[model samples]
Target: MPAVQKSGTVLIRAVEGAQGSSRGLEGEVRYVYYNEPVVTRVEPSSGALEGGTMLSLYGRGLEEGSNLTCRFGTGDAVAGRQETSTMATCVAPPRPVKDVVWLQVSLNGGADFSGSAVEYAYEAGATVDEVRPSAGDSGVDGQTVTVIGRHFGSGQGLSCLFGTRGRVRGMPMTSTAVVCVAPRGGPGAVGVSVSNNGVDEGQTRGGFVYSGDLKGKSAFVYYEGPERGGILVSLNGGADFSGSAVEYAYEAGATVDEVRPSAGDSGVDGQTVTVIGRHFGSGQGLSCLFGTRGRVRGMPMTSTAVVCVAPRGGPGAVGVSVSNNGVEGETASGIVSVRYEYRSGMSAKSVGRSEVRTGLGSGSVYSETL
Candidate 1:
């Protein structure tokens, strides 16, 4: 019934069994659990997190592969800071914060205790209320820019605007300023982008008033050309067809009036072609098989509309239906376009056209396509 003390190696201590505090003896000596592991710094400095971000921790005594947990501020636990054998990598969950945030992880052996933590979040996902330069400004093209939004750090988080192409640029330490050359004619106010971690906020309005009509557009033509009986399309309405083989025909000979598709055009794909001739109106319709679904970059529907591009489909003959709209001399059914490349003396139209392929997928490591 003496105070616990270590003798030789036995740690004679007291034990309060089911009864009450009582004196007892136990083997082995006890010391401090483990040394403290400190977290030093983080990289990329900032992020517009969509959820998972591999946070690299740096600090003294920090070992690789250790269990960890992360929480936003001192409140809700975003994720059970999972443990790994390596101490450096921790997948951070979505936590919205507009200021410098802190993260705490348990260093397997009771190394970190209350009050010990690392700081992150320096920026927050922001909602863009308005932009200073609008979409198209002189110095905007290919220049660093500022995006004004609510919930942003005046400076952090995911601070770049992206287009159809997946490439993204990052922002400065301040959430409000992002540094990246502007893309050609961005769009008007639309969905704002932010990082799930680092910072997050409610939806913020934003847009890219980009130059040229091609900002969010993609246009390509599958063609045979007028010489081969395929329709000839003129994109900008001129004497010469822009060689747009998948001719867009609305007018008879003189170009039809313009009816440009709205910006951010999600054109119809995967169907047949619909040619609107002179007398066409709103009531006209047609049945089409756009090869497979594909997008139409821009289309202006009119009475004398000529649709040259077929839907996203394999290279083959498809059905083209004529309906109300403008039918000056609209074709009745299948407008076959046989692509022929004459080699020696033989006209290879039918023979060469038969070798086309469709979408290919695979079960494992490899896939074949022709």
Candidate 2:
């Protein structure tokens, strides 16, 4: 049977005689009213290309039955459920390519679809690059966090996953930015992720930090070093080192005191060098530079010490410096007395061999197998 284009009553009568003969005998007349399904809108008109997005359709003349199905573009129709006279829902089928497809509803299974159609877009997977204001107080909630990345479609059902703890609704401010309220969490750093449909998620490892007692009278320190995680410090400045400490006492600017060995093989890249410093803030973005040769990231061992892998450089001495902000040439502290001499013939192939080494300014010979 053909689909009903308009809603109205239909009358049917069967004639027993030939046409134009005014009929000899007529059968009983039958009357029926037909109502065409109308779909007004579809919520979350966009989803990931993998599909499995439950779509809610709203309109009139939607009936409850077992034959309802939803069709996407030219693909096979999937089953749909009618919840009321004006609402119906169905799961979208997966598409191999990302594109815009027309969504239509069918009351009689896959036989036909509603006259009106809505556009649904299948997008590529989302990704996260950074989260701004990454650190916040654990005791507070509703901190606004801006997530930067790509492929975020505009619609409802967007959410943010704070570690494995829970999710909060996310609002898309742009294609590359999503804003969400940070939920209350325990003190520590946690991974953050964003999802369009709560199924496929994009994550950033160690993207956020929750601090403890940030506004208290006494100073509190929260640190996450490369080797160890989550170290907290509480100190006193009065007699016996017990009392409420002065504000910003421990927030002094970082200072570089010395670097051990102060020398390495110019051709070796993985040689570990230790830097002794003061007031190295406990967080991300710590780095070191070997003069103008190269800048390498440093791992904080404490407020007074940091470890870094020396970068490859030419033979000669270069001023070593540390940048608490992880930026090159933005040295937090450097001294002319502290220098690392990158010597020749100290390549990796020279290891496990006997050699005579001279101590700086000592003029003493030391026999060692390196």
Candidate 3:
């Protein structure tokens, strides 16, 4: 046996013994060249930090074999089943942080190959820790809201979403912050989320509240008696206090004072009850925070009144919250909301007490036949 260092075609002869002459077996052996991999492009040039993107690498001389290994970033990625001499596939690994890592490939224990020809960008997943002015009114359009979180890059791929309204490509203030104009939604609570590179980041720590305050900078026009209404006072340089109004009037937060029919039997699942609280803005923005069952349909009759059907649950104390046009944090500043208690059973006397049932689900009234 002898060493074959160079690539391309070459002649070779085999000998039987260690020191035997090279004429024992005389058959010409032509060596085939194994060229280095030349990568052409990487599909879906970018991916989320959470990984799981199926990446395709197209090039020539990819050199396919069981010993072939392809990696993305500094971490290991699972090699895909579809591999050939011209193309390869792999599942990207999770990237802990945003980066522009290159792809590396090794075949048959040979030297590793990597370069700019195969670059994959690792974008950190979008996260929303907080949404400033967490609440808004459904009537207000293009209401700017500040989103605070991580990996909010200032790129074309960055955008925000309010529930089902779809992505609103926002202006990125920083890698952890963004400013977006709130889209018009129904008078109810909606989830606030962000996305990067077309990948959804899930719901934020809290949701944006749509209230019925009808309070924005445009709402603050002072019509003086004749022509002296403080000269149309502009408290701030910009007369539009829509953003501030949302934060101050509702999003600043609110508290629940009491829930009518506070004490009920386990069978009170479908009963309509009125919730009394401060900052329960009048509008379709009202939603009931019913423990683990999540937000239930409710209506804000006024700043101090909300009507909702009792949520079915086991006998225990459950928290109740009301928001006026989706106020931020769904509570008033410095106010602690009251809780409702569920009892195991109520005597027939309690059930005999006649209480008018207001229709739940939609804020409408229908005749009760019973």
Candidate 4:
């Protein structure tokens, strides 16, 4: 057999007998030789340290085989799948830290690899710098929250976690910004975190606040006398408020008239209670206060009715107050007359028997064995 330098069509002749034997028959066949694989470049030269980045490799003289493998830096080789004669893909392995590593390919499992190598960079884990509109309504869902940070690269399994409730899928708007919908939660401040690969996470402590408080900034101005000059206040650090305008109006405080079925079970939360009122402003800040215990946000169905959920409390009667501004000292008038009672669901009557009540203060009762 003769060794060929280039890959092309050639004629191969076979001799049946030993060397120089003229009595034997000769057979000729066409054959083609392939050169060693040469990698030209690799797509997505950078990825998260948690890995799971699909890398596309393009090259010449590449062949499809079962033993194909992709090796990243000094890590173990990962199995690769061939997409075409000149294109193959593989998933990158995880790295302990940020680094720039060389990527190599192997055609025969891990025994041998291609001579050419490409550079691949592993980025640092994402960091949370700020969350815009740092506060939101605790009773509202699907509120768009923008997350600003660094090292938020493009990848799968990207999500945002609000406190410890759970995670929601995040959409990457840029390398430093991600958008996520806020989920409903209780009133308080919570930590916010972001994950690019769903394994390693970067968090901001007390990064977001869930509140029933008013959503916008408020200020009180007192004037001694009327003047011709007008007062101008800079907003957003004197940033341009293009396509926006400011206006003022005189808003009257709300007044509570009556509360229906003013009672509920003490053991449950999210009991819908209706507060009949007037001058109830419709917007994001309306809320119902259960004395000084808890405050649940309210939604105004009309100027005469504001609906709210009752929070769980100990058995007793508490004053139900409605506030259109959601401010602490701005509860509506006639609040003392409106009341809600919380009754115990079960009470002991005898040594071995208990009384089970079905509704709020007044309902059907049944005897049960304890």
Candidate 5:
């Protein structure tokens, strides 16, 4: 059956006799067609408030005519081109406010498309007000610097730059707050910038000061860097960092500053210690190494901390090191060091008696001389 031109209930009567026979039996059939257009999705869901965005609507039963109208906020789309029954294209008009607007399309100039699947968000005019802890040491692991500003809008397509070489992006809290790591840098004032969907939005003047530090912080997070991912950073105090933090995949590096349960007994198998630092990936494959005893399994608790079990080892002032599998980059690897003390205990020569206690489990027991 062909599609109906209009919509309404229709009743058809069928007569069983000749046209002149009024006494013949008769039957009736009813039919209805839903001609209202259905909108499934809108392309490029976000655009600048200044408008002039080419938007495409995908759906079914859509026809372009003199009565067809498309509205975005208070502005009406211009030059609507109907491609097919399932697709249409138009240019978005300028909007006065930054918000999520319903995309309305009418086929008969009387139908409303509000509360439909089509929605567009105005995301232009992003600005950066300030960066907390503007000054930082280069190659520091897991230092969280916050960017405060307006029109951040979900921070989905945001990115940032710290200095000539240091850059980081991640941890979006809201439209007003974003937290990122301090990338590796050299001695100088670093520029900062925020970008939304590849367009530069704001810049800060001398926002971050970097010191001359050659050591790289061992970061364990899995990030593609500014090239593929970003967080909003401003320059002048206000635009992009001078260098690319993502270029070297430096977000995986971290710097160790503190450790807990720093001292433990020798040959202990299950001593838990916390490693606090920056850029630790969430539950990433982290490991610990004490002296030359080998790798100890660890768990990344947060972006700034990790917990690991101390492995069996001799007593001495051994250094504690942490590593992760996420720091595979061309520039550097993820690794950091801190000191841990292993207390002296009984030596092997102090053993006196060996008890063959097989019934007390499948292990041997020995007594140590006093």
Candidate 6:
């Protein structure tokens, strides 16, 4: 069948034979080649892009004088739709929705092909959930952020879109979480997305919001040095730590690899603590928690030793940190006794994670007593 432009549309002509009229009244509209062009194939389909793109339509029975018309949705037909004898190259006009539609083509001979628009369909996945950290947390550029949403495992494009001029693509996704690296994004928060099929419009009702930066508070501190997996030290019960971690495969197994102050010595205001451990990828920095309001950091390090300031927080075995630089790793625990505190006497003792480091310092301070 053939398609043509007629009456502002693609028209198809069919031949009919009448026994009473001399085998089709010679010429006119009845005696022409008959058959409407059918949409046989669309190469490189799925017109789901914002920039300009081309489409190739292939069909059988294509003859001279064929015209193709394209439209998005059922709205006003697109103007200036073009076509060749065998194919049509029409630019897709703006659409009011994200959907599937048909491109109708008509042959002057006698055939018409009206096909619906193409859309991105994720065949095997669905929308999952989303995750956001507590009130006072921050993410850095190149740090992995997880978005717990479903239907992202199909290995499609996941773009963490900023406002208008900026975007980061390839956010790794699993069935539960879609992980993306921060791109030094501004305005503090942006939209969590599984591009082409994440949320409804541009809403983040169930998406991740990135907090401002917190790395400025980190002081370069003790590290056992480089390895494959990431090295780690713990501050809270189950937070990702730094140093000694090779690939950041560090888990909540904060046991054997612990940081400790030199034996028989008490942590003073300006003393450096000695650290010991495993899995420290590249120890970034550390800090201490004396009895203060917000956390702070002091001494920074590239190697083992981290200089720490006795936090102003009231006594107790205040927590010390082996601060990791957003790298993944298992955190180990250690202990340090705090002196000169508001809470009076009985030098506080802290075990495993949950120890608070008020400010920046290096080395491990909180551990268990044998």
Best candidate (score: TM-score): 2
Q: Arrange candidates by lDDT, highest first: which order?
A: 4, 2, 3, 5, 6, 1
TM-score of 5: 0.38
Q: lDDT score of model 1?
A: 0.37
Whichever of 1 and 2 has more lDDT, that candidate is 2
Note the Cα lDDT for every prediction shown: 0.37, 0.65, 0.61, 0.66, 0.58, 0.38
After superposition, which runs of candidate 6 have C-alpha atoms over 4 Å from their true positions? 1-111, 114-128, 132-140, 163-165, 171-173, 196-203, 207-370
Better of 5 and 6 by TM-score: 5
Per-residue CA lDDT of model 4 for 1-370, tens digit only, reads: 4778886668876556666774534677876554667788887677677777788899975674457799887776899987887999998888988899888888768766778989988887677766664555566665667788777766765778876657888999998899888777776555567877664456442255555544343433211112311112233443732232223233445667777556767878766667787777676768888886687888666777777778898999888777665543223222445787877874443222223232222222222222
Off by over 4 Å in 3: 1-49, 53-70, 73-75, 80-91, 96-99, 104-116, 139-141, 200-203, 210-370
lDDT of 5 at 13: 65
Superior candidate under lDDT, 2 versus 3: 2
Rank by TM-score, descending?
2, 3, 5, 4, 6, 1
Task: List RMSD in Å for every model shown.
Answer: 20.8, 14.4, 15.6, 17.8, 16.3, 17.1
Q: Using lDDT, give the best candidate's number.
A: 4
Which 10-residue window of candidate 3 scores lowest in summed lDDT?
A: 223-232
lDDT string, candidate 5, 1-370, tens digits: 4567776667766566666775534677875444667788887677778776677898887764435567775556445667888888777787787799778776645344534557888766555666664445545455456776666655555666655553455466787766667676655545565545333434443255543442354322212123323332442453434343422222335556667756767877776677777765543446666656666666665656666777877878766666554322112233445777777773343443332322222322333232
Model with the higher lDDT, candidate 4 or 5: 4
Query: Which lDDT tens digits does candidate 2 get at residues 263-319?
Result: 777777777777777766546767777787887887766677677788888889988
How far out, in Å, is residue 98 in model 4?
2.0
Query: How many clashes show up in model 5?
Result: 42
Better of 1 and 5 by TM-score: 5
Candidate 5, residue 152: the lDDT equals: 61
lDDT of 6 by residue, 193-213 (tens): 444333222223232223334
Better of 2 and 5 by TM-score: 2
